[model samples]
Target: MSQQTTETTPARLPAAARRGGGPPWMGAGMPAEKSMNFLPSAKRLMGRLRPHRLQLIGVITLVVASVSLSVIGPKILGHATDIIFSGVIGKQLPPGTTTEQAVEGARAAGNDSFADIIAKANVLPGVGIDFDRLGRVLLLVMLLFAGASLLSWLAGYILNGVVQRTVRQLRSDVEDKLNRLPLPYFDKQPRGELLSRVTNDIDNISTSLQQTLSQLLTSLLTVVGVVVMMFVISPLLALVALVAVPLSVWVTKQIAKRSQKQFVAQWKHTGALNGQIEEAFTGHELVKVFGRQREIEASFAAKNDELFKASFGAQFVSGIIMPSMMFIGNLSYVAIAVIGGLRVASGAMSLGDVQAFIQYSRQFTQPLTQVASMANLLQSGVASAERVFDLLDAEEQSPDPVKPAPLTDRHGRVEFERVSFRYEHDKPLIEDLSLVAEPGHTVAIVGPTGAGKTTLVNLVMRFYELDSGRITLDGVDLTELRRDTLRSEIGMVLQDTWLFGGTIRENIAYGNPEASEEQILAAAKATFVDRFVRSLPDGYDTVIDEEGSNVSAGERQLITIARAFLSNPSLLILDEATSSVDTRTEVLLQRAMAALRSDRTSFVIAHRLSTIRDAHLILVMESGRIVEQGTHAELLAAEGAYHRLYHAQFSQPAIDVDEATPPPAVPGAPLLRQR
Candidate 1:
């Protein structure tokens, strides 16, 4: 069967390009082929359950006991029926018995209200009703039913606890797994979709465990017990009842086969729809500005319609199981009744036996239908389980070296030797790069947008490892240092500022969690964040939301700067940190940055030529190499890439570098010509 593939949004980049991790459905829905195999997934799920074996054993034992009690109940009721029949036949009792007499008879059976059962017999001559025996049998059957009900309830209660615990553990494992996953793994997934796996998929598994697991064992036991009881009562009657099995199986198989694809479709479409909703809402402002409301609605409707079709098809088809199975069961019942009647008339089978067998026959078909119905639910749950397991099994971040060295002396001398890297293997972004940043040097990196400026800084911070060669900090290999230790020595503020929901003070002191109130205030004042916070209604205590939407872009950037300042790291990275602010705010930010960068090795990725002109050493990158590297004055004198870039940004009409005389290099520092 042809499967529908979810279409990606044109505005959103491919999952590989997305830095934020999310559900796979955000980029593409689960492939139809992936969900076709449930065994491997099922096996993995069972492996997870191994730790709770003792609890499961207890549950299974309880289920067995519960099912046994219920299965034997119908026969006990048949004995009560026989007692009633005997009483009626013995005395030729009236066709209609009064409700009062029934109450009296019941009272005489167990309650001490009636001293003599004969007085309450209520039968005519030639045969006296054995009221005592009849009453006793009735009481026994009632007790049997009561016991069965109790056992069933007890089993379900225990099973609920067990299933809940299992799912709880599963949730914990998923959360821990997400923590260990690499940034590259997240880059290829949608954040919303991953959220769905954590919240929605696990919830689905929980629901299935509660509803299906409780009954699954008991139902199977019931079918087996009912079958054995049937054969013991009468093989011929058992044979008649058994005929329904094949018919029921055939019907269920046919329906389930047609619906299996629909079920997979239902899940796939659901994920796709979730992705669209997430994308649309995340870009709500952009959609409005572009007047794409109608377009958004149209896209949503298409996805909705697809979901509706898949859901309806799955439900409508699986919905056929119960009625069809019932019809077959009813037919079997009529066959049993007709055959048992003749055998009873011929004294081949007792009336009680026939009645018990009929009840057993009904019990027989009930589980068959139930198992068929649960098939759909279990499939959906298993599919969900597979996705969760896939996430848990995803590649984790490279392990930290054992006994990793710490930055004992935080002088911040950094070196890159023959480094090579690429986000995508074939498309190299940085090639054979080498650089030296002496302690306390501000190395400004300037390039065109895709010139791998951020990529280079990513390598330095060990967010990404080099494809070849080594990067060292303070004469120690970075790879040998623990990731936490490396990151602790460095702080970064990206072009995209992220602030958690918290007060201004709390956000500033985020990196230095134990920062004192005075220290926090000092950092905020240093970054000019105090200037804006004091204007707010609550000053430093004002609360921000998840996205910090309540604060202006420039203010949010300033808060991030304050956070970086509080960290007081030996190395700092500022990637377009001032891009969001106005010129006036940028000047204030620059002053703050200057103070922060002093006596620290900082890598500044800047697009503004003016901001980086005074940098100690400006590295002008083109394609994947440093085309020009020197002090700003030297680069302007060379009249190379850096000269052209500076002139293009700050100078008026494009000046011909060939016509202009090259400025001389600064007397103290000469440009290091690359080979």
Candidate 2:
């Protein structure tokens, strides 16, 4: 309500260094190697999964069942082949004996044994094999395969539900963390990078959970089971297959080591690319005004190309792992086949045993290759997890007091007692500054840009804690009172007006949502906002777009003023609150502010000298120090900093106030001495 210039004055405002002085989109990209503690990160990742321990155990059990069932099929089929051979050679399982006992007895019969005679029995013409035994064996094998598949499906179903719920919890935690983080954290981080953490990084973990996790488990189980089967069938053949294991492991490790680096770069470039796109789109107007479309496109293309190269390197390197392991596996198979055949010819092994052994060898090598291929996806997932956990592990702000003192009586008596504050430890901005504003007084603060005017206000609001001294409101230390309690009694109107997407009535009622429609209308009328609202097609119901683009800048300022009026706080801080309105509109606003500030204490920060001529007291600041303070007449007589600033602002046709005709003053306004 105070008379203050609403015109834009960039020179009087300091650049926000924490925002990094550019589009929020121009933040640095992710580092290539943030940390190399893989084992620790992996452990933490598993720790997160611990919540679903039951589901994981289910998956493992199903995997074991599935692998065992699959492994049994080949052995069953091999036994059937042996039976058909016996039928052809006119030999049968010894009368009333099961196939197992007959085979063991024939093996003990040695060279030209009954096993060989029985195998030749199936060769006789018109000597049909027994169909009964073959039918039962085939049926059992089919049933085992179906049961294994059914278990796998159930395991996958359970895992899907578990993964989704786990991700939901993770996303919720990140959202909560954002609200608790201190202002400094946001200042140093990019909007897009934070977004990537929530969206991209978390999504990668989801994919790994849905696919890589299960695949890795199945592959490991297959490898272990096959190795055991190979040794049981024939130790010599198993030894030959075992040779491929070490070679596959060594090759996989070498490729993964290189691919891991590429995967890290890929994700890093992805974050940087996202940041550039966000910046370009958000500031499209500025880009066009400066004719920077080509430049932005160029920058985008460069980042995209970098991402492409990294992605290609990671994927291609991982892709080779499967084929390389297959080659070694095939070589092992050939060696095992030749050795087993020679042993069979010498009557040391049966054809069925040799066939089963070869099958197990193939199974053993397949899973090793699968595991190697999935290593890329797992590595990338771990990288993403590391970034997410880092955000969760960040240091939080100091906790609120368990029992805070209540701010009572609500007298707007504010005092700063030797306060000092600095954004950085080495560069002290405000050193031992002190001032006082009595109840029901209009105190004006005028200073050049970066002179710490805003910093002082920030300290009073406790946006940043002071390094020393204490601020008192109504004779009580501000720190002892709850922030919400202190802030509730004080109303603020910042220069950059923020009006969300909502109706005019809603925007005005934002400060006091519980206010009735009549109260909202009254507040709007006080600030002349009602006049404009009535002119709109929907009146007060007219919805404002994002950034309030539908209304002119002046109209937006009026609505903000209306919001402040609706709050009806005990104290007010106006940081060039009327800087956007025209001179005519400003005059109306000044009357509204006068009525609003009549009873409540106010601190008005302004750059224009004429606006604060009737203030009860004025403080002139320079380089974070209060250099002069007094009423207009007293400061002009002193002929100091305020004198120079006053004369500079009104050098032409200066109107001098006669002692006989005193400037107007609100009745009962306190007069505080300048120190």
Candidate 3:
């Protein structure tokens, strides 16, 4: 007979949706806006590079060498220009006349200013240009430029290696941290949002480091080298160039400050959006069944629009930085050009020196512009780093004992001693509950939803710890035994079957990897899984899809039961294990479980009264307390809570009393129940 199963409530809505006031996207639980700590986050990110200190030092050395060469090249070219200019003027002078004679002649012609320029130029009055010297200077300048390029490339190569290694280590740390976190932590965090932090945010950090690190380092060094060269050529021109520094700094600072918030919002929405998408896809069938496609689409559109706004705001604000810096730099450039021309004409500076200083000025402004332009990438990367760091800093689960107690025997005797637990502080679910199940007995638990039926078995598995009391196995406190040790002797088959994407044979073997082929086949036959496997084209080799959707629900449940049978555990837990199978199949499963339960303890949670009629002990639970405990006939005669539950299941119209009747008890089929 098929029993009617009531659908449980959908997952709890976000707090905002429950209150009935907020944007549609807020249903995703969008994170509240928090002020970004830019400097601290940036500093923390740099600290990730600490392990590569030696490599960084090498990179710095190379950059310094490269910048130095670059700085000196223009000055050498300027000297070559001076040589050419002086030779041209000397060639125009009268034959056999010295440089002093040319100056004297200009002065006598009442051209004192021109005479001063002639003196500063140091013209050889009777000589033409020195072609040999000019050629040598030119060749030397080309070599300096080439050497600078080579060193710069080498520095970038080493820096790239350092960034990749650092990011790799960071990924490994996040993965490890995830495993160390407590189960409750996962309950509170959406899987999609967590995935974004692990994937998208980390990728952003890697890209930021790759694109900005080398360029920022080179730009700053170039700025310093250019300034020094500028002062060497003419201190006045260098000071004029420096007037733009404060303005550029102010511009970058202001823009970065505004854009930082938008970047934070952008990534935050990205995670929220990913979470929505994940949930929608995971429950796609449920959505379609309820005709909620439009609602889901609306929610998605709202979140997408919010993300677009955040991304646009971040880019638009940071985009203003380059043009503003360029304007300030251009103003400085015009001032230097005017002052340099006047100085040259007045004989206060040589034409070659002025030419070189102009080059230095351009070099100075260009790097500043480059640095300013990189603000967008830097801010976005730092924002992502902050998210990744938050995950790494989450509180971890309590550690296992340094010295754990040993479990020498495989006896399945279990006991709960005055246990107390609650998911929340103010709401207690189970209080001072105690029970005992002897070895070789089947204990059946029956209860309505939220009656603490599943919670009781979960406690025995140590999926959670009790608030006030401890559980014991074979007279030993469960806490003293290592979790892995305790779990190794136990096997569980839940109502919701979980199977990985693999062949049927592989899935069955997952429970006991070392089990021989004969053992696997025996387990399959015992659970009646072999009956279905033989009908498939590939038999045991049939591949299950990732979602296990290719098989029927009853078939999936049978596979899980077969897996548990293969484990040969000392204790077994079957929660609604036979609910998905038909009445005939359930009869066969009951027979298989009877054989499997011989000389081993078992806990069965069931709503169908027919399944547990033969159990050794039946526990009737109500509001976290056991209201009745006894055999089916004994409880029916007593007319207690169990009598009411038994009568309720048989009285239902959908369950025909004759068809719902359980078969005669098989020898050694001991079990317990609570409802």
Candidate 4:
């Protein structure tokens, strides 16, 4: 590790202009629009169902059995009521003479009204009600129903356990999928929408599945079993109850269609809100600095308003479904009642049959509503799954070819052979180009703002692939080597640096996790940042991260340089290494860099231009093509493009007479050898 020296110098780091930051909770670069099929994502969600199948089946069995038990008791109670009343009334009444004799006696007494009342009193002689027999029967039935309820509750506890655990696994799986997805897939999605899928969508499914699966089975079993019992009692009454199911279904379908789009819109608006909030958090200081606080607030207000409308629309419309189903269900129940009652009155059905048919009619409509409610939740889950799976299934980082041979030894040789590439295929940012740098040689590339300098470096790093031709390290084609193995042998100091949450010691040691504390301190001292670290109250123990309210650009950059110094790769890429520092810091950074780059193949892209005057070889690029190459003295003698650009800088040290700067030569003009 090398130390970079830092002097107390004032300077400004360049501002970043491209990133949108993040949207609220989703972070930055979430997708703005949705794509991908809901069906595929849903099919994927079904795979989660497979592991919970046994519990699912158990829940189904218990709920159905509980519902079946519900119908059994009422019928058994009715039979017991009838039998016990007959036995008690028979015990109380004369062996042969029934309540009919009392009615005849009353008629003989010439009281017509009393005669009718006496005839109506059958259970006990001259009394209208059967109290003793009925009370005993009612008591037994109540006890039986209470016991069945106890069993139902016990089974319900088991189903609750299943619901919670199943949902937990599903949530974990969705998150695992997101983690496995490549960086580019997240680049295309909105964070808020993604969150909704993982949270709201999965929640919807869990809630619906738990309630609907358990109750739907119960309602369905009750409806079917009760109808069968009704048929056993009187088939004519059972037929009347089936006629109303179709009408209830039609109502539910119409309501579900209206609410579907609302939920989708709700998800989208929430994403936009999330995006706005993320931007605010990342740039809160900027908002104040630029005096754009009002603008940001207004934008947020609009997003909130839109979110409010969308959320209300979805919830309000979906809420209507249950009540509407119930309304239709009520009307159907009434119609069944009238028809069943008429059948019973006409001798086509018994009283028990009529009672059961009414109960079953209610049962039939209840499941219909349960299913409709389930559909709403299922639709939401499916929509969310669509968004999440789009990311999960999208193209990811391709693994290295099987059994790739490692680079024999980089020895710091890099070459681009007739390379042509574009980020967007047709843009052709880098046209057919070729270049090479040998071990221990310094390659300085200088270019105008969009002259494809960074693109060249990106290709070398394999962050993006070439559309044509190849890049090679140590004469081995880049694609032929394992990406990890190749990259591990290289070190980089990027213009932008990030520090994770940890102590300064840990941050430096991050360059190589196995590095001892002594090595970390040595590396920091080499980057010239050790003096400041020692001044801090905690020294190496000082914790730093993005959230750290302290730590400036110069401090961060020095630490990064120290990290690279510790890495000590044979091939080094320093991109605008000292671009962020003041003159004093730059000079110290340059000293540290010189120590680090010693005897290594270094590619330095310097915006300062002054820093690279000592490069062993300088390559000048324009419009993606290398147009100039030579030592400082040779390029100055030629008086070419390098010469012109070198002279254009506002500040320059008095150059060696042979050093590159305009006049006798023009950059890109021609190569010349001078003795």
RMSD values, in order shown: 10.4, 9.4, 8.1, 9.0
Please, what is the TM-score per model? 0.86, 0.82, 0.87, 0.77
Relative to the true structure, how large is the alpha-carbon lDDT of every model? 0.77, 0.78, 0.85, 0.69
Q: For model 3, what is the error of residue 133's alpha carbon versus the real structure, in angstroms, after optimal superposition?
A: 3.5
Report the C-alpha lDDT of model 2 over 183-221, residue by residue, as the tens digit: 556655556667888899999988977777777777788
Clashes of 2: 11
| Candidate 4 structure, TM-score to reference | 0.77
Error of model 1, residue 313, in angstroms: 2.4
The full ranking of all candidates by TM-score, starting with the best, is 3, 1, 2, 4
- Stretches of candidate 1 above 4 Å error? 1-33, 93-125, 653-675
Model 4 over residues 1-675: C-alpha lDDT tens digits? 222211110111011212223323223333345544546655676676677787767766766666766777666665544444344544644545567775576578886554443343233452333566667767776776676677677667777787678788877877777655643344344444466667766677677556655665666777778777767765655565555567667776777677767666676676667657756876688778877777778778877887799778877777777787788778877877888666644445444545656666666677777776666666665656555555456665666678787677758899889999754544556888988888888899887766777667767877667788999899888787877777777787777666778887777776777787788778888887797898999888998966545787878877788888777788888878787778988888788888877888999987777899889888888877888899878887888988877777743555446545545767676867678
Lowest-sum lDDT 10-residue window in model 1 = 1-10
Per-residue accuracy of model 3 over 523-571 as CA lDDT, tens digit each: 9999999999999999999999978898999998999999999888899
- Candidate 1 per-residue lDDT, tens place, 1-675, comes to 000112122222233565232322234333332663666766776676778788888888877887787878788777766666546554553345553554465465774332123233333333445678778877877776788778788878877787788899999888888767765566556565677778878898888667787777888889999999999889989988988888888898898778877877776677667767887787788788878788778778887899899989888898888888888889999999999887765547666788999889888888887888787787677777877877887888888899897678888999989998877676777899999998889999997877878778878877666899999999899999987788888888877778888898878888698889999999988888898888999999999998789999989888888889999989988888899999998988888889888898999989988898778999998767888899999999999988888878888666456667766778887788879
Error of 1 at 15 (Å): 8.8
Best-to-worst ranking by lDDT: 3, 2, 1, 4
User: Which ten-residue region of model 3 has the weakest summed lDDT?
Assistant: 1-10
Instruction: Name the better of 2 and 3 by lDDT.
Output: 3
Between candidates 3 and 4, which one is better according to TM-score?
3
